[model samples]
Target chain A: MTTALTVETDPAQLCCEPSSQPVLNAVDAQESARVLKALSDPNRLRLLSIVKAGDGGEACVCDLTEPLDLGQPTVSHHLKILVDAGLLEREKRGTWAYYSLVPGALEAASARILGL
Target chain B: MTTALTVETDPAQLCCEPSSQPVLNAVDAQESARVLKALSDPNRLRLLSIVKAGDGGEACVCDLTEPLDLGQPTVSHHLKILVDAGLLEREKRGTWAYYSLVPGALEAASARILGL
Candidate 1:
């Protein structure tokens, strides 16, 4: 199944306004925090790194399993979390599922924090 | 007492490399995830937004309590978490503690996710 998602502005820049000013509000904080929680795990982080470093900026399930030294199910689980958090996108081709990073998810998230 | 902390790069850009490229590693995932875990909270995110939007890019304990509708101790607790996560810097100005956003922390995190 192909899930369509919206790519927001770079999170790094999106998180806050210029350094001299303040723009973050209560709602912004809660939303940003939820994004952070998604990346807070060692395995998930590793999985993301693997995916980002993969050829064509994407990795398939079978290719990811060995590098993570994790069970296929565990790797699959982490990929699901990344996908749910909007950090990664999944595309199934034939029997394999290929995962790629969401273009602006990270940037928008980081921008909120950096105010850059 | 004053605590000195190092502000890393914007999390957004720091998380990953340019698209069509992969640079994330095992270590990067673990480190970035830890950072994400720090931002994955509703209260903490709100607190961060409040701080970022404050004057002079900083806010004091007394100023934060009312906006959050949280007890002083709870606000203090959340601030501590942000500070611990390196998302903020705490400065003791007289009897009050002032909090400010850590430059680049958010960008680095977001970049990691966006691979920007």
Candidate 2:
């Protein structure tokens, strides 16, 4: 899916005025809100950071449980949410699941907040 | 208050490896989650866009109600949440409440997602 929120905008200029390019419309706003909502939890953000910090920019499900003081099931649930939200990608390896940050996912979300 | 999430990072490189810089800790994750949860609503984003698109990058509560297809109270509630999140600033002028984007608020949030 094409992420409209990924549009580039200057960090120095945060607000997008009406006189400027098109503002975030209702449809785009709703879609953006959904992904933003996915990122609204502390455990989830922690999980994302852990997975992001793993070796080779990827981590096994087994390695993620210790850092956040969460169990495997709870951690897996958070990982599932992040995966469904398009922020992460998951791969099945034997009995373990490997997770990685989807390239440009965080940047796209960042762009949406900075862009209109 | 200083915003740790506002630390700059290259957008092209989104992941934060364990061997590299510090990843988002639990405390920062919670703080970031609070602000992110604030941006998780559709109407709120629409309201933000309306305010952001207004003249001088600000808008009045009266002007905001109609375009958003919501009554004054509803719109105000959404505005309050955004304000609490430090995304919008409110000013009292006469009988109306004027709102404007807090400069770099969005960037701080955007920076957080990109940074860690």
Question: Residue-wise lDDT of candidate 2 within A22-50, one digit each (tens)?
Answer: 26788999888988998999888877887
Computed on C-alpha atoms, the DockQ of candidate 1 is: 0.21
Q: Model 2's CAPRI class? A: acceptable
Candidate 1 has an fnat equal to 0.48
- How would you encode candidate 2's per-residue C-alpha lDDT over B31-114 as one tens digit per residue? 999999999898888888878888888887767766767787898899999999999999997666789999999989988788
Name the regions of candidate 1 deviating beyond 4 angstroms.
A1-23, B1-23, B114-116
Candidate with best lDDT? 2
lDDT of 1 by residue, B11-66 (tens): 33234332332245667666777677777887777777777678787877666766
* Chain A TM-score by candidate, in order: 0.73, 0.77
Report lDDT per candidate.
0.69, 0.79
TM-score to native of every candidate shown: 0.71, 0.80
**RMSD of each predicted structure:** 18.3, 15.1
Report the C-alpha displacement of residue B12, candidate 1, in angstroms.
Answer: 34
Per-residue lDDT tens digits for candidate 1, residues A1-116, read 13222235433333333233224565666676667777788777767767767779787766676665778788888888888888899998766688988987766666765652
Clashes of each: 36, 0
